[model samples]
Target: MSRARSHRWLRRPNGDTTPRFAYGADYNPDQWPREVWHEDIRLMREAGVNVVSLAIFSWARIQPTEDTWDFGWLDEIMDLLHEGGIGVDLATATASPPPWLTTAHPEILPVTASGETVWPGARQHWRPTSPVFREHALRLVTTMAERYAGHPALVAWHISNELGCHNIYDYSDDAARAFRDWLRARYGDLDALNSAWGTAFWSQRYSDFEQVLPPRLAASHPNPTQQLDFKRFSSDALKQYLVAEREVLTRITPDVPVTTNFMVMGETKGMNYADWAAEVDFVSNDHYVLPGPQSLDELSFSANLTGNIAGGRPWFLMEHSTSAVNWQPINRAKLRGELARDSLLHVAHGADAVCFFQWRQSAAGAEKYHSAMVPHAGADSAVFRAVSALGATLRDLAPAAGAPRRPARAALLFDWESWWASEQDSHPTSRLRYRQEALDWYSAFLALGVRADIVPRGAALEGYDLVVAPVLHVLPAELAKELTAYVEGGGHLVTTYFSGIVDENDHAWLGGYPGPLRDLLGIRIEEFAPLLDDETVTLDNGATGTLWTDEITLTAPDVEVLATYTSGAQAGRPAITRRPAGPGSAAYVSTRLGAQGLTPVLARLLAAAGIGSELPEEARGHVELAVRGDGDTEFWFLVNRTDEPVRLPGVTGDVLSGPTGGGTADDPLVLHPRGVTVLRRPAGR
Candidate 1:
């Protein structure tokens, strides 16, 4: 049989020419009685849920006892859903191991950095590197694969529920040994490892591999080198578990795609989705933006990260609340049109599927108050109606959306090593956060309507016309070389303060400020000025900027001044500069710029790099822009996130049209409050 589309998981059966939608929400059958399955299926059908992710946390129910296995209930449920025309995204049910397994196999439990044994009952309590846990998990997966490998309803395999609920890496004996093995494989020798980690600095030289310990959070004076290693080790540790599970599923069910849902912008989870992307069929993410005024950016950034993980492949919005989420301190219902608009935004930003956390509202447990497709009363609530309407629209537009487009020529390099190194440095500024700085630049670019890709520093830098690396504290030697080559080859490069200070291990590089990139930037550091809380600085453009400086340096030449500290001993010094590097140009910001001060500067910079907003020049206000690509086809997603309707000059169809904008890209489209529209250019246009 011909394989399904390489990027999308086709929900419709082979030989069936009927066009079908491929989006749905997670269903918890175990939470409700079996009698409710029929009603749930009817409701799902009405809500346009063609696919249902099942048995995510059913490990305890499926195999309550160590040796016993039960698939009868799940089989019935899957069959019932299939009969109702809903496809299945079957989960392996390895998210939360049964209580009995932990009690029977105490070694399966994880130990924290402070020598605390994580008890049972909480989710993600298992030690990832523990052979005992791995063996049991494998058995669970293998048994499920064998049982449901050829099930007609199976469309995809969900490896586990949020792979890093408790941060996968542990310092237990099992994990420690595995860390050593991984290091050996990467470095090949103890000598190379020693030099990489700079073990000689603190008498930490390892004669034997056994001397190494997993980096803990509670170190008296944490070694930055050890900390960086720990981060990499933790990410790899989770990879081992996911790879093992994917290997088994792929072997038995090669036709079915497999994936694990990742959390957006989560650091403690120990999940490096970039590394996990290779093994997964497609990257999926759970987006839960805390209810607030800034929720739009939070949602957009999450979707952007998910898109990045799949290498621009359309991803699944695996879990989102239809209304209010109970986990936050203040749970506010998503405004009238927010849910529909947000869901469409996902599609516009390359989401193949949009699924919620639940099908029906729970009556008990921690997530009881969480929103669902069917509210607690099981009636057609406002959220449910909106979900149903969107579902119908998706079914009608399935074929058109099945293959969209994404075109991006700008990129922002996001490095976890650099983030860790900058934050963990016992250095000039304690208030410095790598993600915040990166987001500042990202927000600026997005506001200006630039389609930018968030990538790793090590990714190929040739294709991008403009590259932004903000607060890249740790410059991997190879990546530094690649960036040098990129700038030398006429690629526009922009970097902020605290960049290129250290190597991958967080150890400072000798010579000058931005040590590795100094030659390319044509500057060096003389001294660094640390500003007190909320200090203001003035730029050459007559804009005032804020500085929470803990360190400032002026040790460079051939730089044009951009900004200066308004009050300080170094009042007249340049806080930002630009210089020529070979055929291209480089810009450097010596300090963080506030919102008002940063946006215009970035707009000017991006324009100079030949990237501009696809939106009409007359468009204004809180607008979000995203581009999705499928071969030569491209789709432009425009979202007016404000409270008022905005009219655009371009002709575009309303992807979620419902008596709002007509379904044709003929005249100017008017977006209602919190409105989203996807405009597609026909292939080969």
Candidate 2:
């Protein structure tokens, strides 16, 4: 069943015998006049929209009151969409419960860490552990599944939109009980729980399971183990909700593919999407371009991560903006051609579809200021023109949807447990950001036009020449063994400070820092001298360290220093170390390198590993290069994000977009500012 579902992921089922690649937006037909419904579909058909995600937040309108349902309007909405040759990714409409249900069962609402009850001014207010919430939510899912089981327009089932986006961790009494039960299932006994949480140190040992509670209103950073379990419980609790909804979905609409939109932006460590990927038929994600300097890099990083999450298969680009957003303090509009640039960038990674937030602009509600496909300026607007043009552009390249992403030669080990543990309070420094530290390395590879997949810690390390694990604060012994084996088998490794220092329960490894990896890295840390935010230290080898610095001493004869601190109390100590391990070598950096310093450090590592730049010096920083292939055909998608044109040398292929008759020996591909060119070639090259 999983294999069959995987086959249906990259494209619509072949049985449809129609044009593929879903292109549309979230449709809220209830927001418009009944007379405006036909015009909405007409404009959709005109804009080349073949898919519409219907009824994402219509629970109130659909149910209205207890013991009542109005499927009459939904019936017309589905029929009209099908009549216009548009497929429906029908939603369960359970994201936001109606006011009636919340008022009737107020206990279902979530409570924050400070004990404030979260009311229903916004969406997703119900507590996942509340039986009142669960009963009503499951009933809604069952009803929707049964009603749309055989509807001709129903192509997929979207379950509980963006599960746990607004309310991930609730500190309510219900959640406390649920957390205790989850702990019991994990630890099996109170004694095991007490030991794992290390209750003896804090005099907080529990004698009974009922004594446990969510880590809340703590005096000073509650037990780190309790914090870790709460994160785990929160993730698992949401997954349980998805499982319940899936049970109803498959029981009725067994044939309809099921999925939920995942908000998988950078550093979003609340929910581990790697585990959630297994619970769905096909992976789908919603990404909003971060409004800042590294926005483009972030978009690429997240899209690559999403594709990797889907296991190299093309996933859905469920939601993005056509222009400005409403949430950020300084909402900025997309520059000319930025929309097409952003959308195609996802496709270059592995998006089988191009979608947005809404079909029409909203004149009311919190999100009314958010951009849409059809702007308030009407279909004749420039934003609408760009959306229409992107639709036609994507529809022409439908054959590339099912191809796999080219295998990465380097892997960045991304661990969710580390992300949780690193941010715990009372750490060495609050400046140790998990995502930024990761993006620092990831951006280096991106800037050099080299592609690397963000892999989980447990993934096989046999495929890559180099593996990088940054800020691996808590290391399980099994993973430690795996890293050792990876280096012994001739794979290069790079790890940072505060790694291999503890077990999974936040218990420090006894004897010294980097306990299990000491021999591999050939270094010992006696103490840490974390620098203040404004302090900076230079290295003897021309690199600079900031944010963190550790006092290091060589423990092995073969260990070599790559950099040494030339300032502060830890002066003359090794800041970076390298040592040979069997067939390959392992390197460690004991302090965060400055932005300019990482370039040279990464250069030395890449050169040592025999991994070279993917593009020429001319094309290195000028373009974004990504490859997707199967064994017969390969596609090289080059996107030029800058304002200047980029010239590609020795490039000839079936140019998806360019002059007539495609590429020839006489002409090389040249991408204009913010332009995208997808060139196809034989895999034999």
Candidate 3:
């Protein structure tokens, strides 16, 4: 299950063998006049641009009317970039179909749950399971691969841009047929399908496979298992499409690696990226900073998770913003020092390449206002200067390229199924956010200056001393056994409320709440006491709980109650509990205590696990530390998490690249507002 298959990297256009950080953006020369092309090359050299993803959304331009093909402009750009010593991640030009193709075959369009056609005014309008769409897309892909197979500027192949960003869930006939096939493969027979779906509950049992359809618009809540299976089928449908494109590219141009950008930021959780990680040559992600209180913490969490998805190997920061993005509710420009800070944070996690969405800001399209390397204000703007500065910083830190993420003593398990199932309809509480709970725990670790890796559910958990699985709601039998074995083999486990409540089939575990984990946690609850929006509860540990609370009855003699409710309907009851198993322990938090509230609780757990802050005590909350590299040397990325300057009393390392000041074991190092510093030192030190 390891995603360590890719050992290849971006091939140098000029064949330079030196290891260097990849720097570039998505190049869209077709949007502008031919004269601007030369100027783009000149500016690219000035800003240290090395690679560009080409022809991502150029399907219409590449195939004007489905009969006419245009490669003249593409040929010129490819030659021009090679002359300028730049490499190209050439796209398949299948992100969006030409208007003629869609107009001719309207069946290719996706349909909503209410049986409405998804119109094509925007991008990603084609359905993933449409055979007509696949035919056209594969034709375009084969043409591009054949045309650029021998080009020196060609480094990799970019599959359809952000595969399922908009059209993930299609309820059209094409989707229904594909969903049935997926279900047949998964269940093997009608009896197995009925058993897994619990179809007898609502007289939804099916005797024929043809009667089975997607969990479409229904009278009542669609069968929970049906909905879950549909989600799985949709993701698999898209993954199969990706594999189709990848197979073609690999067959034609076997040396060239292929990758698609994954949106792993915020709540864009439609696609299961952990499953898709192994399908690509290397994992690449497109992340945008969501404006919120835990914005930076969320960025770190996303990056950490992406790194682990890449199997701790160096991945790609395919697309990010140099300034404000146009898509948010109120897009605000990035504050000073934030541009470099954000890019470096991705590098700190495991990205060897740093790229933006577009090289030049658009002038007429929907994303015209989106920020770019060369913004609408041109090269003289602050954004361009910041981009150039980041380019220079990356060049100076070339030694950090190819370095793997340093594994932390602790890990946080992130499960996509848990996220999907826990937030489904008819749940105990609609206010619960699975990702936020995991991020809150990550923020708590940040607050305590303790590093924790955010790993996927099935990832190996043998090395981590303490594993925190926040709201792991969907627990299959095999996974249940795995967790039990992990704890019994001296791994400390911690999970939250609403976890282990259901198995893989979306059926309750039958015994009690937190069913499979009850024995390990040594606690049992009869039912859930979800809180209203305005409700609040106080815990004896000085933590405020919200969203949920559980009354627990300890079943093990060694189980200990760590915190109790002091002000709620369940007064004086257990709010947090822990049970020891041999040399290991399992803890449970029966209430939702946010980042601030979770810090104290995490401190206790970390102490018991013998893990402490790696940073100076004074710099705990203000500065974040991420390590990279292997045995002999470690690259420490110290990021200022605040807008104010942070001082570290005793930080020691050879300054690789950073702000003006340096720190010894005796002197204090001052980091500017939103600044980041990279230090290189012996791993032992």
Candidate 4:
């Protein structure tokens, strides 16, 4: 069977075939009085809102009792939206259960690793492995699907909101039983499970499947492989819940597509979304800007990864903040032009649908202070004005609605298994972070104005001229062979510290460090020399290294030393090495050189790989460029990366949307501060 259902898009209530961006927010009519809904729809039209994801967190209101369902309010709002020509991505309203259900069945509540029961005061308080929770949730799914199957305003089905957000690691008896069942399916027998988990260590072997338990709060660090498998099982358990809900939705309303929003932002790594993308009709993501210097870089990296997870197809931008969000420690309002700039950045990365967390600001709730399309100041506010202008901008750029993200010359490999395994206890430096290293590489690409794709581990590698795999600590044999083949087929490969050290089972490669790739990289390390927090090492190339270092030995006659250590214990030794393979080469970096330090280092590697930026020299670091299109035409999205205006030269195209401007042979195109401009140009430009 295919990995995912064919790409399905939202259609208008009138069934119009016109190509336009899906625009709106999470409409919560249930949060307001019935009389205020008319004003909501009127403002929606003014903002050019065509679609809204409705009833996401309305479970308590939808079902006040086990036998009672209050659909009268829902029916009225559905008819009102259709009359106003707005389509709906109708949610199943199972994001949370009613207070009555939880009070009746407290067994469905999750248990922490410390053996404490999680109370029902917050959202997502139920366990994924609880049969009682599934039975009640699926009943709600069935009722919603049957009632809205033929509704004119219905466009898609929004599944449970952000699965595994809080309840991912349940350690109750129910979860123990389900985890054992999952392990049986994976290993088949206790003997095989022992071999795979290396349970012989520390006298931890299990005689039968019944002896296995989650790596809960233990006396000391639990078995490493067992802990890794528990992480895997937690993600799989939630994926199974999503599958159960989707089966009912597809069975009742097969024509309407189904999707759940994925939180693909900073450090929310409980779900393996690449593995889950195959189960959905279309992929949708919720991204919020993290504060700091690398905030925009992190957003771009997440969007790039999400687009690749959808196989470069058009996906939905489900939820983002209009200004300051309530959840942050110090929620700062967005500066002028950031609202449109952020939305268009996602559009540049191939998001066809743009939406926020809500339509109207709340009067009373936990998230009452969260920014929305209509803030507390109402339609007269600057936020609502910006939202209206963004809607108009989306309409103007309708021609680029379904364009796929154009492939780039280089890619950064991302692995969820490696991420889960690399940071476990009893390993190297605890300060080592997998995602931060990957983001540093991405930040280098952005600084150099080089467009690089962030691809999952199993994605095709042959399409790129260069591939950078950073901190790929888990080196399963199959991936090892595949990466070797990629290099033998004339592809340049670069990897960093702590890579290729362990197998899928978290067992170290016996012969030496960098076990599987030692030969391919033409370098071997006898020991890892991790540095202290205050320690630093200087490289011969004028770059500073921190966190970790390796004493590398060249094993091949054709190996070349690119850079040498100058101040550490391994002074005068190779800090970076490269070896020529069949038609390409493999390189290794032994330490962590941050974004600024890696800029010149990457310039050299990019030069060797025959890849360079496409922007003008003067605008290389000042402007960010992303392209999206089918083969016949292209849309060039240029975003100003700094607070100052930039003059872009040597570009020619018809402006689709932006400040009115053009550049000639002598005159340059002007980009206002924090502005985004889209240009429609011919393909292969």
Question: What ranges in model 3 sit over 4 Å off?
Answer: 1-4, 660-662
lDDT of 3 at 121: 89
Worst 10 residues of 4 by lDDT: 1-10
590: Cα error in model 4, Å: 1.2
Task: List the pairs of residues colliding in candidate 2.
Answer: none
Reference-based TM-score of each model: 0.93, 0.97, 0.99, 0.99
How many pairs collide in each candidate, listed in order? 16, 0, 0, 0
- Scored against the true structure, residue 497 in model 2 reaches a CA lDDT of 83
TM-score of 2: 0.97
What is the alpha-carbon lDDT for the whole of candidate 1?
0.75
lDDT of 3 by residue, 384-451 (tens): 88888888999999988888999999999999999989999988888999999999999999999999
lDDT of each: 0.75, 0.84, 0.92, 0.91
Model 2: per-residue Cα lDDT over 391-442, one tens digit each: 8887777767667888778888888889999888888888788877777787
Looking at model 1, which ten-residue stretch has the lowest summed lDDT?
Answer: 1-10
lDDT score, candidate 3, position 50: 92
